[model samples]
Target: MDYLDNVARNFTKKYPCYLIPNQSEDKIKAFLTDRVKT
Candidate 1:
């Protein structure tokens, strides 16, 4: 969980225009899947 927290922190720092709330499991999975595809 700490790793994920750090990743979120860095992501937010790099992309301040975006917001990542406590989304649903499916949304998180989809987001990760899209990232992996790229």
Candidate 2:
């Protein structure tokens, strides 16, 4: 589970404004589902 934990930590560190565990899963899913511009 270390890899998952690191990804979570890195995502939080990179996105300080986005809510983490407390955020609605839908929001997170939306972001990931959206295609990246680059």
Residue-level lDDT tens digits of model 2 in 1-38: 45444555566667777654575344544454453323
Which ranges of candidate 2 are over 4 A from the true structure? 19-38
C-alpha TM-score for every candidate: 0.49, 0.44
- Taken over the whole model, the C-alpha lDDT of each candidate is 0.56, 0.54
lDDT of 1 by residue, 1-38 (tens): 45555565666667655555554333445565577679
Which residue pairs in candidate 1 collide? none
Error of 1 at 4 (Å): 0.2
The per-residue C-alpha lDDT of model 2 at residue 30 equals 48
Clashes of each: 0, 0
